[model samples]
Target: MELAEKLFHKSRREKLSSMLDENSLVIVLGSTNVARSYDDGYKFKQNKNFYYLTGFNEPNAVLVLAPGGMEVHDEKSKKIKKTKEILFVQKKDPLRETWVGRRLGYSNVKKELGIDTGMVNSKIGDVVADLISRDKYNKIYISLFDLNFLTGEVKEQLRGFESSWITLSTNVQIMDVNFLLAKMRSVKNEFEIEQVRYASTVTAAGFYNTIQMIKPDMFEYQVQALLEYHYKELGCQDVAFETIVAGGNNTCILHYNTNRNKLKSGDLLLIDSGAEFNYYNGDLTRTVPVNGKFTKEQREVYQIVLDAQYDVIKKIKPGVKLTDLKKYSVERLKKGMQKLGLLKKGFDVTKYTLHGVGHHIGLDTHDAVANKSIGKNDYDKLVAGNIITVEPGIYFPEDAKEIPERYRKIGVRIEDDVLVTKYGGEVLSDSLPKEIEDIEFLMME
Candidate 1:
């Protein structure tokens, strides 16, 4: 890790520590390996909140942060003054390491992660129990979820200790650390924005490459495989989520990932995917004609969705509310649909235009922040450094009698990752072509 990123994570932990009252303890538990089959396990993904604070990726680890003025006893049982931070990792096991991978052990964690103290997992319950018995902590903050990965004999002991501590101490309060961390992560820092931009660049490249390769009669899984291959070749450890390569009416089913159908010549293909760089994710979606040219009806609906996306992106600036933007984008789509004669008087456009226009994107796609709500005074305001998506779509299933014959079974959506700025919004995925002419030109090869 770069020195700057190390400092950035350290500052985040310090910020959280500063937010707590005196004699407060924050417990962050890492995720454990889950069995994919009998003995083999799925890839380990660290808990996002734990990764946000500690920058430690290993499983079955715990990070404890105690604010200043907390009395703690070290391994030697000697009293220590001031703040304390301890990271507990699994002890070295040659057989386990040989089977899977080498363990970092406690010594390396302290040096590499810049943690104040590091100990084996077995010691955590005893140490925490000692602190509780001594009445050293007034407030305890733990992960909000009932984490399935957080299990073992050590954890059982700690759980027992916590239950007893709560029963004994009326003054001690337990709080959810996830809430505090969510508010901190809602806004991106400079390093985080840089990472997102890099991820966005890679994501756009994958889309452009796939666009050039897409052809009539190609299987949907083939397109998914090609795009994912490009993402990995460009240096992304993995995709942020499952790649969605929906062609024809399959595009109407949002979140469709069973990419097994063949592409039809006149159908529109929607590719909604993103790449992850250092855990930062870039979410992008684009729809294009399968045979490199749109028909009259397809072009009409595409243009309307494009206009709505373009207008929504223009309104993305600090202080703008998401609800207001959604309403504005819907009105734009409604007018466009009415002009096309798809809707009668008083017909609601939202019937065909399902889903929200966009959402915040960051460490996780559909970032943890709440969207700006309905009321003018009751919404979250867009702020600089906020990363979001601007996606607008019009879906018409084949069975809809109200829909026009030519436009049936057609779905078109255009999405881009945007970074909110003081002056305006910056398009992070602009490298990928969204214009009709540009897309056709690139696909001509």
Candidate 2:
């Protein structure tokens, strides 16, 4: 890792350490590689929470933090030093590296990751249990993870120690570290904002260049392939999530990733995808005409979603409540649907316009932060440095007999990543061509 990134992670740890109460210990586990099939494993992905703290990208690692410094005996230097952090990583295995990948051995971890002390991860269970048994700390903070999903030498070793660990936990207050990290991650730092902004920029290129190539008779998966190709070509290795390339009636199904169907001439194509830059992610959605010209029905629905999204994005600023934004979005969609004769004045708008207008976007797309309760209160109020998606969608299923035939099976959603600033919301994806005329011109070219 680069010095700048390592330092940034160090600062994050220090900040988190400050948030912890006095005489408390926090333990966070990194992700382990999972087997894909026989004799093979999927690509290893580091835990986002662990990466946020340590910037180490290996499997079966554990991070231990003590708000109050603890004495550590350095085996190499034969000196005793005080430390607030300890990182336990895998021991080097030359044969394993030859078969799989290079290992940043435990001995070199402190120097490489800017961590205080480094030990072989196999000792984590015993080491942690012993620490807890000593009963020096008042509280122990453990990062929450479902044990059934975890697999690794450390996890297996910890499983053996569960009885003792549970016994220790019964005496000390055990806290889930997610809430603290969630609060810290909700507000993006300068580096995080830049990464998210650049991710969006790359995603826009994927959309702009690929959308022009999308024509009738193409399978939905083909469009998904082209978009992902563009993202990787721009140096983004992984997508924020599964690329949704729903076309025709499939567009009405939220989270539809069945990209096998061929797109028809008069149908609309909705591409909801983003790229992950560094660790930050960008999220965006765009609906366009498969034939490069929207029909009268399609344009009306698109305009409604677009206007509702624009209004919601405009309201993103520090101190503004997301609930209020949701309320306003509902009203806008309801009014537009009423004018189109899709609904009566008091009819439930949620039947057509589903989901919250947006969500927090960062390390994980729809980041680990709360989707609705984004504030300190239950109704999350926006705060400066919070980057969220402003997505307003209107869906009319094919089977809905109450709606107009022309509008049936149509889904229109306009989404953009917006940075909540003290000044107001800044559209990180402002460079994208979302205006109807702009989209038409791009497709025509």
Candidate 3:
């Protein structure tokens, strides 16, 4: 299903209501971008948090939820409560639609979004003012830090009636809605998981296709072009992030996106890329030898990274903290590097294994989660339905004299997307070959 079709408003409202005390009014603001000149014009993407809550992708919108309103009786003798959700949208405009695009006015928004009521944007000031004027609602919950159109207008209204008897007595509180929204988006729903799976599948195809088309003499940019072509052909809206096509010694740079290098006979090419589908993303990385085969030294380093990655994958399940995973992977890398003699008897292993093994992936590549620190007993357990990456890498530059001569100038990273589950972690991007023999075979094809 399309993102816009999801019924996220109810869950979002529940979360907001849970956070707020009784008698509070919460307002979310969204607006269209208006450039000063034609040359500076740009398209606007709907705020991810706002879109996550309401599934409203259009610009110039507001969502209001009043928790403490007077209860009235209806004709059926049932208690008909006051409005819980009120949406304000842009008024219909023919001229604007001609230049830009058609907008679903108030009527359509109410029916489609399942809100209690919908109104014109022009009347928002009056409606909000009246709602605040009521003496019963003492606490007002407005997203203070957001400087969008609705927030600015609400601020002006609050300033306008600051001296009035009703407004002066009312206690208004500002809440950081961004934090509340981030917590909501950390866990993935069934629909969201499905969309992410589709994106991962397409991304895997792109990686496989790009690898098959790669030649020893091809420019890195040409390989990047092939990956992009496959992404588009597989119906990806766009790349999740800039494509990284680092080759040879350049792979030592973690985020090398400059695809200007030439693939030599003995160099390894590393690609870290993914595709975006329905605003969800999939992240994967694979490193392969440019000449369809890895040198003995390259295979040694590659096998170690692969082993670390596999060990982490086997331990991924519910209640697995990211910190423990990091420690475990580091220990494995340290042992592997020790066997290879890269580290002396007691040298700190972190010097070689620098970055974290993985991170959350979703609407944004680095999606939010509860874990803030990597402590020994950190309780940020891996919950079911959360998508994460398991990437293990070893980078050794040419200047590092401690390593063997053949192992120098070699960087190998293998990453894959995984979905946490109750039984065990499911490897979403398993279609891509990670084994040394399999990669060599595919490259030969």
Residues 1-445, model 3: lDDT tens digits:
2334446556667676787767777777764565658657545656566666677767767777776543322222345546677777777899988987887887776567766666666666666667666655666555445543434343454444334535454365545566566666767888788878988999999999889878888999999999989989999988888899999998888899989989898999999999988778889999999998999889989999999999999999988887789889888988898898888766677766668899888888877544554465333678888789999888887886777778888888899999998998999999999999988888885
- What TM-score, over all chains together, does every model reach? 0.94, 0.96, 0.85
Task: Assess candidate 3 and give its lDDT.
Answer: 0.77
- Which ranges of candidate 2 are over 4 A from the true structure? 78-80, 146-148, 370-379
Rank list by TM-score: 2, 1, 3
lDDT of 2 by residue, 280-318 (tens): 888889999998999989999999998888888877888
lDDT of every predicted structure (CA atoms): 0.84, 0.86, 0.77
Task: Please report, as a residue range, the 10-residue window in candidate 3 with the lowest summed lDDT.
Answer: 69-78
Candidate 2: the clashing residue pairs are: 375-380
- What shift in Å separates residue 321 of candidate 2 from its native position after superposition? 0.8
Q: Best-fitting candidate, measured by lDDT?
A: 2
Q: Is candidate 1 or candidate 2 better by lDDT?
A: 2
Provide C-alpha RMSD values for all models, in order.
2.3, 1.9, 4.7
* CA lDDT, candidate 3, residue 76: 27
